[model samples]
Target chain A: MSENNNYTFVIKPKRTLWEIDLKEIWRYRDLLFLLVKRDFISVYKQTILGPVWFFIQPLLITITFTIIFGQVAKISTGGAPEILFYLTGITFWNYFSSCLTSTSNTFVSNASVFGKVYFPRLIVPLSVIISNLMKLGIQLLLLLMVWVYYIINSDAVHPQIELLLMPFYLLVFALMGLGFGLIFSALTTKYRDLTFLIAFGVQLLMYASAVIFPASVVPADKQWILFLNPLVSLMEAIKYSFLGQGIFSWFYLAYSTIFTAIILVIGVLVFNKVEKGFIDTV
Target chain B: MGNIVIKAENISKQYRLGTIGTKTLANDFKRWLYTMQGKEDPFLKIGDTNDRSQKGSSEYVWALKDINFDIEQGEVIGIIGKNGAGKSTLLKILSRVTAPTTGQITVNGRMASLLEVGTGFHPELSGRENVFLNGAIMGMTKTEIRKKFDEIVDFSGVERYIDTPVKRYSSGMYVRLAFAVAAHLEPEILIVDEVLAVGDAEFQKKCLGKMKDVSGQGRTVLFVSHNMGAIQSLCSRSIYLKHGTIQQTGETDKIINYYLSHELKTEDELNLKVNKDIPACVTQVRLLNGEDQKTKAYLSGETLRFAFNIDCQAQGNYQLGIGIASALDVNIFSEVSELMELNNGTFEIDYQNIQVKLAPGNYALTFNLLYNGKSIQYCEKVINFEVLEINRMGETYSLSKGAGFLITQGKFTIN
Candidate 1:
């Protein structure tokens, strides 16, 4: 008899519609954490400034948006100061975009590791979300410091009771990004056409999400177009909650939540189906 | 037999041929539509056999077809075959890295696979960091890796540069570290695939020794290798795979003999062509027994001779070389005929009975033609032959790693 505990593992073709075994994921949680740590550590290992890129990237992008949209284009912030307005948008936008791009590349980028070893395939994308969550936390603090500075120095910005809703907004953001990322990645594994389309499509998606201009400036009839996007309502609500400006409604938030939940469910189902066979096609 | 630790029931894998199989969405939709109607997958019904040469008539092929076997606890089994024989595919399915098209496998214990050494070693990570990373990727926990960290470092013999980035290490050093980490994974079942072929001869011998020690410790091992000597020496039983199906499986000597004799008998040598970049090609290779009779196999007591028929585009000073490689693809010995000896181009340059000291198991002959101090034509594993098992120097075992790669005349005493 062997010294270790006896365990039997069965491997067969995945026949079920739902192949996402939560128990397997739990068993591989340590690998998931290591993958997340690797992604976080290796990102800046060779750079002279290291993780300072995390701060500099969003800061410079926010400055460009401020100059291009607020100063030149005459877009309104709806009473919130321009710096805090764009800064808040950049924080959430950066997180959502990074999540989407990384998730979409899950099978393609990790095919080497995935092809060689046996771990829960979900560990990869979950790590993407977890590692990005750490980056988001640091970026969130940076945004808060700017928000506090504006509040202490000027009357152009103010915090409202709705600011308490920020955590819910973050959850919704994570779910939507994670869900859609899973969907795009699963599809593109079989057909490479989506890879290029996603790279271009994700950029265009930002324009529609109102990352630069305030949602209140839109014409009433066109507001429906923005609402149809699952991320738009959540982004506007996140800003309105903190800035006390723009329209904020629990109904729209709830609608976005339902939309994200449905997408996430579809994402999981598609991801499960494709992962088992995607190795061959890819 | 003891308890069955691994059982594969009716395992098979079907692959579609050509780019159209993977690149088209239309066919996938068609297949999906057929499946939704509760019918057999329409594409799976038709295909050619898994042959790489010549164009086939169908687009779908079964890579591994209905393979069934059971391994008892603590049994070390070897799987061997030529290229495209489904050996790697079978190992992949058993390791759970991929799923079979239709089959089930039950494994009764923790299993770890070393499909390739250093599979997840990041170039930027130091050797120490990669040890933890690669171990974790292979399903080892932090505590488990920590417990064996120093042993792994010691085994690799790279402790002096454990903190240096692995990218900076020489290839031999990298292989040392990678193999060291993988070897230390103390799973109940170990699956290895041709990984021991990486390091030098001494290291390979060391790895084989380590693997034998592991099996002795009561862990079941499934090994896939082309090295018949290693297989004959290490495995208690063996499986011979041909074109994605089990051709034979039984005692180690029986299966290895069957595989070698099978390969030597059926391999059509007219198709083997040397490098086209050169003006010469090796037309045929043959081995004659001591009685001057052509043979594909011989007993260890018989004299071995290599006779080659070569062709040249233009008659000139051509030096012909013959290289002998173990079944594992290691070039152990090579000899070349002098240009002065091959003046008559078409009827010359053959080596005969220099010394036949090779131990038992399969070996292959590779040829190189040097037109003037430069190798213009070369071919690897062009013609292979087996040295069947026979008593060596009064010893019962003739084929074994410890028995050595070649046989030498020695005095034996029986008092």
Candidate 2:
């Protein structure tokens, strides 16, 4: 009995501020995959269109932006076809928006399951991000097909070496979305007023994220204000890489990465502190 | 003895009472500031015990307080308490569903809690999918679930609907499948909280048997239930909780007996103070032992005595009745005195040495007075008392509810 020096775990009143417990999340990796599968299958179970609905949403939104902003408003697509430009922006923005919105509802949406059992609470938000990434994969295939058509006939479209950095752009979007979502999820458990604000906030953030209009269209004087969003540079970078015709600054990309890193750290810390006792408050 | 698998020290949980949202952020800010300054939470100073019936004066109340216990491996410990006694809270903390406000718990080995069944069962997902999903949520890996898939299905008895979405299945089938997945969860330490209260009696028995098997396999279990019979049948040791604190902890029988007699608020004497001016009234009723001493509890199949004082201003062909009723409000049995004439005076009536031969449970005593079958001065549920599980022979005889209260000695003949 004296050899029981190393207990499996010790539960305490307070954990260190930086203790995120990544290994615990790794242990619950199966649950994360199951939840992601649930999210994917449950949503389109009864629908006739099914997975096709995933394409319809981004395509419809892209067309709407093309007509309303590209054609009617005569907004320049930065030398790329209006459809290709808006579709690229929407595909990436959809991933981040859905990730942010869904992940932000982590505590409120999963209170029932979380209240009854114990798992790494981080798994819920992480699963949301992964599932949204899958959705983005499907939508990106749609964007690639459109790019192929434009590349065959149009001379304005340019595929460059920067296009290889697509993964980096996606990494920034996921981290930023997850970070903000975690902070909001933790706060919303107690002050549910944040739930209503999230819906309205996500919509307003899209207009500022350069999803509809190209970053070049923004006056240079106020372009610095737009870059502060951290998403603006990533959006421009994605368009510049695919079409080879928009602003893609390595410095701004680094800025967004650093910003995402800091937010992710703070977000995880807040979430860890709240997840322990949110059951009582929620 | 095996090594201690779980050790809790001074574990307490405090919850804010009333409307939590009103000024909740301000309270959080205040608590944060206090902690930043290296001081105690100012709000924690003033709070009441977790008694849900009375309105508390302070906004914060300690749902659990200073709970300390240790469980060695392979020990099945039952937590017995009334509603609002923090049994659920303690289980929640142990399960890691929630953290305690003060103090710490050291746990060695994998722990799983059945605080509820079908916790993450998706309605749109098919039963097979839900089995894997729910299993994973309970801390089983995909491979582990796959290994136990056939056994889980066979145990649930819902093999026909395994491919069907759970939302379309009947409520019973849903519960059965849910409990089936939960049963297959083989964690080193199990925390269960009244999950057997669901499903039918047969299903509850199956769950109990499964739990017994788990405990028999040398795994520690912490069980919380209001059913004393189930607790007695499964747990070797028990902890009795009352008002967020441990009242007693020891052998299951002793803790259960203490909980029934003391915590249940049994009454040995009842003062009706019936008006002396009434035609016939029961003024006082007292339960007595064989020695004519006041007692609130009795063993099964024991002789019981009762003494009552009656004030009758006018009586003609009057009848006196004593009725015993179970906790479920069912009338178990009744005995009545023969019709007789009585003059106006205060008289003492003693129904002594009556064979109880009753089952173990809480029961109420009903007294009645009637004149010429008019049913005058009838009182119901005057006093409540408990019958211990011990029988006349001093052997522990476990009696379940609805097993028939009257114990009989039937003559046996064999060919």
My TM-score estimates for the predictions, one after another, are: 0.87, 0.84
Q: What is the lDDT for B309 in model 2? A: 88
Per-model chain A TM: 0.95, 0.96
Task: Candidate 1: give the TM-score of chain A.
Answer: 0.95
lDDT of each: 0.81, 0.88
Q: After superposing candidate 2 on the true structure, give the runs of residues whose Cα lies further than 4 Å from its correct spot.
A: A2-7, B267-356, B359-383, B386-415
> What is the TM-score of each candidate's chain B when compared with the real chain B?
0.78, 0.73
A153-213 in candidate 2: lDDT tens per residue?
8998998899999898998999999999999999999889999999999999999998888
Model 2 TM-score is 0.84
Which tens-of-lDDT digit does each residue in B326-399 have in candidate 1? 76556778888877334334453347754667777677878887886788767777777776665556544324
Error of 1 at B268 (Å): 12
